[model samples]
Target: MRWKHPVLGEFSNETLIHMAEQNGLIFEVGHFVLHQALKAANDWLAVCPTFCIAINVSSVQLKNSGFVEQIRDLLALYRFPAHQLELEITESGLIVDEPTASDILNRLHILGVTLSLDDFGTGYASFQYLKKFPFDGIKIDKSFMEQIEHSESDQEIVRSMLHVAKKLNLNVVVEGIESTQQEQFILEQGCDVGQGFLYGKPMPSEVFTLKLESHAQA
Candidate 1:
């Protein structure tokens, strides 16, 4: 599988967002690309109402001047509720430029868009850092899920994460789940949500809707 992640160095803000919004799965759009995607949606919001689209925001995007204002403008443009839209920020971005990142995130929280810490365990997993931000949810990375079958360490990691999230009152999403065993394991661990090939590999929105309808009536 071509795991979705930013190239780190090659993409410009425009190119990255265009590629992500047009072709990638739900979560791979680079932060720069997502920023532009929101900007692009302003006109659409004026024409027709729709569900919120989750966008990935980078540390660089957070550090930009007027970032919060830009987000506020976009939110205001849409007639939908604030919770309809969500912004996924990588765990590493939280501490990259600590104060700036925090300020920008805090501002967004005030604006009322849901915030999620993406790829949770992949970054600095300190208790202090977890307490620092206002994240509505944590996306358990696929690496940990992939290890659940054979690795004791992975099992412990998932359990530990679920434990902490419960204590903190946060929603947990286990990503990259590809088996019934994985889904059952996550449920056994008390995780709230999960997504993976076991449910269905990522497909176009129309196909996904058809699958949803079939399952709903099944």
Candidate 2:
């Protein structure tokens, strides 16, 4: 979702997405992105059968009654396994029309599609949504990592999140792990999965494929 203008130079993905949302075009944009993502995932799986792709779902898309059916048709079209496609929704996405969101989420769950609550603590009703939604996991927001190594309160907050997630039997993923210290702290706290610059920055599909091939050969 990157865009450049002659006068403005370039716009961030988030800014473009925000503009789309404000213009009431998020549903159309989200659908297109979902389709393209599924196609990309299908292509990637041909190279690495174990690879799984996670896509973010917009609140507008969730509100649409045909959302679940669209996903079903796309998975069938791509011949991709439902379990290999993970749909991530934020707390804010679930807040608008909770019942509708819950129903759609439940159906997706039954269809074997993995669901995750993204940006776990940033929303106002995080815990409430967690209790109501059928999420396979939660991604602790990247903001938590900003000063985690030096801030006791931040560390305690993350520990609390991990503790609650453990009680719910949910997989926990901490985002924005940029250093060995941050990674070690989360690892010591029993978080086994993380995503950040420590691993790699965003790259083109070809670049990622090359890296994968190199790793496989090694």
Candidate 3:
């Protein structure tokens, strides 16, 4: 949050953090949000059938000594189904320390919560990390989507990524698709899921709830 009340108003998390005088509260807030993830998943899935939620855990969080137990406790406390939750961890987060990463990743897998390797292509030791960890899926970096249609090389890259996913049996969710053409092309490339402005821009929870209610009614 901003140190001083914004004269213009800060309406988003990014802006709130940007206006902050220091990074002191970010981790605190993030720590809180980790719990909120459980609450949201428990509350939402209670009312809606066949739904899942994804939460990103930072590298710092992953390496925390109690991270897996914290999740285990949260699941027990909230009675949240581990299968209904997916924790997306970045490549850098996992590769920083192998033994620690290996231990926690295994614990997470044993807990039955799905793991996704976030930002698939932009980090170090991508292939090696994938092989070492039991990740359930991959989130293709948006950089490739920057020119998916215009660049044959981009399309080829996308295809190659899809091929890797297939061989590894890891689902692919391509990001940054912003047009009908891009969406169609990504589907043709065998991406399992797509996210970008073409689907919907990020919005406040109130707006999302209204849309969700509308869909439920429909």
Candidate 4:
């Protein structure tokens, strides 16, 4: 299988987007792919209704007027609450085109869909942008978890992020928590939510559902 992104030319679109979508994993899907996925989700809801899925929203999608319309139409068709769907945009996406990003995110907030800032520290915008935009949560990048024990800078950054989120009253989710120590630290920090391989890898609908059911029962 050719695993290149057909659009960007730099990356295999297949490995980048298609494989994730086909497997029902929560990864980046551009405007075109997201529209199709919404349609599929609507169809899936009829039979399997337990999974709450998230999709990445790129900067280009935000600037387009049709994006919000697409979301509204899909919600009407699927009849799922906005909370069940998450729209993730990279922190860099916010700064690349500020005005458009602000407008688009505001509209999405009005629509009641969850907005998450992915890869929090990788972007140029500082903590100021966090206050400027209406984000529901922030995802701390996995890179921070590296050498956390001896690296005062890394630890301080994480602590600062946690402090900022707490003051802002926004949710914090630490991603890429691959080790037990990382998991324990996040929990100790009183982070509201988390996602990492330490908990479970992304799986198909059936497997995801089973895991959720198990957790509820436990």
* Ordering by TM-score: 2, 3, 4, 1
Q: Which should have the higher TM-score, number 2 or number 4?
A: 2
Ranking by lDDT: 2, 3, 4, 1
Tell me how many clashing residue pairs each candidate has. 1, 0, 0, 5
**Best model per lDDT:** 2
What is the C-alpha lDDT profile of model 4 across 1-218, one tens digit per residue? 12334775454433565454456542335544566656655655555566456777755566666677778777877687777678878865676688988988898899998888888876677576778989888888888987776688988889899999899888788888878887777777787577778877655556655666566568
Cα lDDT tens digits for candidate 1, 24-86? 432434434445555544434443355355676766566676777766765665444577678
Error of 4 at 53 (Å): 2.9
Candidate-wise lDDT, in order: 0.70, 0.88, 0.77, 0.72
Cα misplacement distance, residue 81 of candidate 2 (Å):
1.3
Candidate with the greatest TM-score versus the true structure: 2
Model with the higher TM-score, candidate 3 or 4: 3
Candidate 2 lDDT by residue in tens digits, 1-218? 45678999877666776787899998788878778888888888877888888888887777888999999999999999999999989877888888899999999999999999999999888888888889989999999999998999999999999999999999898999999999999999999999999998767667877888777668
TM-score of candidate 4 on Cα atoms, chains taken together: 0.77
- Candidate 2's displacement at residue 23, Å, is 2.0
Candidate 3 wrongly placed segments (more than 4 Å)? 1-27
**CA lDDT, candidate 1, residue 34:** 45
Q: Which of candidates 1 and 3 is the stronger one according to lDDT?
A: 3
Off by over 4 Å in 4: 1-51, 216-218
Runs of candidate 2 exceeding 4 Å displacement: 4-10
Candidate 3 lDDT over 1-218, as tens digits, reads: 11234586535543543333255554566556668777766766655766677777766666667888888888898888887788888876776677898899899999998898988888767777888988999999899989877899988888887898899999788888898898999877766599889888766555766777677778
